[model samples]
Target: MQEPTLLILTALADEPRHGYGLIQEIEAISAGRYRMRTGTLYGALDRLLSQQLIAVEREEVVDGRARRFYTLTGQGRAALAAEAERLRSVAAEAERRLHVLRPGLQGGAA
Candidate 1:
């Protein structure tokens, strides 16, 4: 539901990724707007894991460091879908209100 959680879920929607990979994908998805730190990222990952929203797909040792790949579970996918729909609804409402408040705002030059 939160922005970080949404971004994390959305990032995993495409494919499984480790911590660094998730960070890159999330930054890409957000157009470099949200750069997550290591601490924040792992905290969210741990919470998501505890909530059963995501699961570890595999773990590999690279350069003597363990990299854990995570994937979205079925429930995670469902939750993401629901959140997307909710966002669409909210955006639509905002657009409609803006159209009313500022005439010619919709489908016209600002």
Candidate 2:
């Protein structure tokens, strides 16, 4: 999964979130590295929800607006962990290659 997607998953790992809350959490978690426009955020949410990786837990009204709260399913947790492991594996391999190529210290910078 892409980092943005993984980041959404990570944010939800903390708690269930509605659309706007999820958006804010992802941005915060990324240290402002990621900021999703509504279009892209909803697209990713739809895909994950359809896959049963995330589910609508409930709905609430705030300021007369209905908001759907989403939570990670067990499958979602597993998926997030698998994605993280995959990234870690690839990162480790890349660093190893960097060590061989450049032999310098940015934790084996290439």
Candidate 3:
């Protein structure tokens, strides 16, 4: 999966969030490394909805504007879990190789 897609799924992992809320949560999750534009976010939301990875949890009007809250589907949760495991495996192998290359190195010290 793409980094943005992964980040989006992760942001939705804990709880439902509206578009703006997802944006804020994704920024926090990436430690400010990524800031999704509104257009990009909505586009991704549309794609995810079509893929059944996420669904609109609810919709309501606030201050005369309609806001949609999104939640992850079971398929999305499973996909996220699998991707996390794959990342962990890759990281572990990299760490092991690093240790072999530098016996005294610890914790990614350069």
Residue 48, candidate 2: C-alpha displacement in angstroms: 0.8
Model 3 agreement with the true structure over 4-109: per-residue lDDT tens digits: 8999999999999999999999999999999999999999999999999999999998889889999999999999999999999999999998668555565557
Query: For model 2, how does the per-residue alpha-carbon lDDT over 1-110 read when each residue is reduced to its tens digit?
Result: 88768988998997899999998998999899899888998999999989999999999898999999999999999999899898899999999986674435655444
Whole-model lDDT, candidate 2?
0.89
lDDT of 1 by residue, 1-110 (tens): 88999999999998999999999999999999999999999999999999999999999998999999999999999999999999999999999976684555655786
Judged by whole-model lDDT over C-alpha atoms, candidate 1 comes out at 0.95
Per-candidate Cα lDDT values, in order, are 0.95, 0.89, 0.93
Pairs that collide, model 2: none
Task: Tell me the lDDT of candidate 3.
Answer: 0.93
Candidate 1: count the clashes: 0
Q: Which residue pairs clash within candidate 1?
A: none
Query: If scored against the real structure, what TM-score would every candidate get?
Result: 0.84, 0.79, 0.88
Q: How should the candidates be ordered by lDDT, best one leading?
A: 1, 3, 2
Clash pairs, model 3 backbone: none
